[model samples]
Target: MIPSLSEATIRHHTIAQSFERGQGYYRAGSVHSLIQRGDRLLARVEGSEATDYQINVYFDQGGITRATCTCPYDYEGWCKHIVAVLLTCLNQPDRIEHRPALATLLASLNREQLETIVQNIANEQPEWMDAVEVQIALLTQSKTQKSQKAPRRTTVDPKPIERQVKRIINRYVEQWNDEPALDEIREIIQKADKFLEQGDGNNALIILGAIVRAYVQDWMNLDGSSGESGAFFEELDDALTEAILSAELTTSEFQQWQKELKNWQKEVVDYGVDSFEMSLTALQQGWEYPPLQEVLQGNITELGAWEDEAPDFADDLAWIRLKILERQGRHQEYLYLAEAEGQTDRYLQMLTKLGRSQEAIALAEQEMSTAGEAWTLAKTLRQQGELKSALNIAMQGLSLGGSNHYGLAVWASELAEGIDLEIAFQTRLKAFQLQPSLPDYLKLKELAGHRWDSLQPELLDTLRQSSSSLHAKAKAAIFLEEGLIEDAIATVTQLSSYESDIIHPVMDAAIAHRPDWVIENARPRAESIINAAQAQYYHHALNWLRRVRAAYLQLGQQEEWHRHRTALMQTHTRKHKLVAMLQQRDLT
Candidate 1:
């Protein structure tokens, strides 16, 4: 019923910043395969991550009635990937031309046409062939048995599931060479999802549960030098948790599974708390499993009483109890538990939620001696309309002088809103004097507003006079910001300690205006970086070398470039990897 989406409508639905980022993604050709099926538009968007995220946007008469993406950005209603897809749709409306559903398209194709299409897909993606073959077999069986009544659902065997889990992990470990097997692990989990989609939740749970056992039993003890193995396990844990929550089981079935879990807990060494916590969460969310509840309640009581003997277990148990109490609207019990556990944030949150503002204020004031407490108290005071008190607390925290004083200063300035801009500027300037950081200086300039031009000289003077390394950088930044490229370059070159990152802007500026100077200054640093870089950093060294080459080219100094290349080759003659890398790029 809805009209085709326009760029203006997309802008209306999305925030400006998200829209801009999405536009960049679209321009980069990140969105692809955009198609319309009935009222839905689906596309694949390549994101910052290795995998592409699939986006589905359902439109109705109200424009975009619903949209979902596979990216982990639930905080924003839609992510840049979603925005990219929408922008693609707006820019290329013809791309959303109605495509027949897969079933309909398949039905219309002749046997030879279908066979050719399947053969082509199988050649490109053999994994998809398994599903297709299974479907074909199922169809043949259905046709053969069409005259008979429907058969009972067959149960999936746990042995085959366990074998599949072992096979997947073994293949991943062998092929990935100890790297994180996130993609392989997700592929295995997707098989379980297929079961769930086919109304076999119990089978899905079994598959995920088997994978968890295999991971803990065999995979955890391996040398995870790549650091990806732990992330893989985390993903596995999430899959297991999701399956436990969503899978449906009868009372007897649930009790049997509970028994198996307890048996595993006793048999396995340091059994993971993730599954147990997920079970507790399911109970908290009103899952009507009586035996599971009894088991969890007993464990909670046992762990709660063993606080001194088993502190870790006791803490976990307490968290579960707190979550349950909070969910049940038992604020009094939640408060007592929070206070007992010394959870200040939770205690404060509970107080505020219960409309006990006076008590919350009292607690906030009492906790204001610590930097973290001061910031929290100041924000709470501001929210309570006690601006002066908040400002005083923030100022006191800043005077105490710690790592977090800059944050305190910002909080104080925000509290001083409508009071006095001059006072706010002075406070921020004092913070800059204390820290001499670029961020604080910029904040001070922001508060200066219309008078920033007048204040610029004083700011530059302060930075130039300061002995701090950060202040020196700030001075160079100011020069660059004001477009005094020569001054910026001169200041950076004269610095006693040279950071390659800080020298980059100066090098870039010098390349255009003073190519000779860039060639002279950059050669030694590039040589040092190339010599010191590891195999992984070879690309970074190559990029720096490219910059040096560009500088030489800019000055039309081909002979000097050849001489520099010869010198590098002679100096690093024994570094085979470096020589090969340079020769590949014709740098040697």
Candidate 2:
């Protein structure tokens, strides 16, 4: 069911909070629209570029609330776009609306309801009965198309087995949507079975192991049918068990398989510490499968003991496990581990996962004390929609880091955002004084980009007092802020011509101007950046295009703008997607 305007806004706010916490601010910008689809919202934002972002907000079977983003900063499920979208909704609540009551309930169905729903779906959409056939047809078409292509043998240099295994892992990861190489796996298993039939169990064990490795690396291992309990792995896992049982293993072969099994067992245990269960009956029937049962028992017994000890180790373990569980899409397990640890930082981090930042920060401040920690804690506060507290903590953190330190310098840059522009300007002045390096000078200028108008009187006074780099940046900032676009472009173009690394801020400033001067002056540096690229130059070029696009749009030069946009889309669309995501968000 569709989320109410209020619910959607709240969800978006949650995402924005995440964006701020993770430093997801790229080029701050505004949104044009948020199109709704069911519980999902597709938001279009204008920044240095234009792009679509998706947000999903839903309730689980237990009526637990959840939200997620397709944006890159959504590594923790929440991001700045969500927050911006939410804030946008809050300011204009007429954007949100509830789905009709007759529409599908915004909740999961119970077992009986699910059965009824299935019957209803079947009755209305009988094509669901042919789902398997449709899937098979699609697979067959893919294989046929592949077979029609000219085959060329590719050479792969032999590497260490571990390296080969890692390569195999990457191959499967890359082919996440493709079918597993199950035919090859079956071939290996057939060879192993033949060896077993010939009474060569050791050889069979070795071959079977290769088959098992393929399965372990295969993404299909995670798929499960929507049937009985554990229905997902029932077929494939049962086949694996049968293969092990039917094998005629000699003592040596048995020992070798045991060792290999133990390693696989270790990976499983590490990946799923909680909610992994094994039937004691399955273990008792065969010593080979005992490790699964043992691992489960060991974890259960340790849980009680773990609670009585210091929570630090538990927090650390939980942190490590959270990463694993997140990758596995076992989000609930990740949250459970975080809650069990009871560490403020850990809990706050988990709050990001659950989209509960206010609760997270309250807990975080109870224990957070370091400058870095305070900065981080402030981000959580921001995520929870506590803007006042977020700014407060950010100020405190900045003071603790001191003006000369890298942390304060970064904070100064972050504070340049709309809500905290004044604070950003003050902090930037201090930063320039502490470190007069070219980069620092450039950053100070960039921070002053939007603050130029406010700084005009002071900038004139500062120009008279000094002729330092700070004066140049302050002057440039004023020009840009005053909408004297050409003047700002000329200033930075002249400065960047002296040094290439000094090109970034100038490029940014030119883009901010969105003037014809940007296309004229930035062209040379852009070419130089391309010519002198060391792998990292592509990113700079992409940034150049983004800012260039922003400038073009501002100047209303549609034709040249489209040309630049097309070039950007052609050369670095994939590369810039993440950048676009970061920039599109309103981290504040």
The lDDT, on a scale of 0 to 1, for candidate 1 is 0.63
Top candidate (TM-score):
1
Q: Ten consecutive residues with minimal summed lDDT in candidate 1?
A: 143-152
lDDT of 2 by residue, 110-148 (tens): 789867876788789988967745456556654334223
Compared with the true structure, all predictions reach lDDT values of 0.63, 0.47
TM-score, per-candidate, Cα-based:
0.51, 0.33
Lowest lDDT block of 10, candidate 2: 274-283
Write the residue-wise lDDT of candidate 1 on 39-66 in tens digits: 6788899887898899998753324546
State in Å the error of residue 181, model 1.
4.3
Model 2 TM-score is 0.33
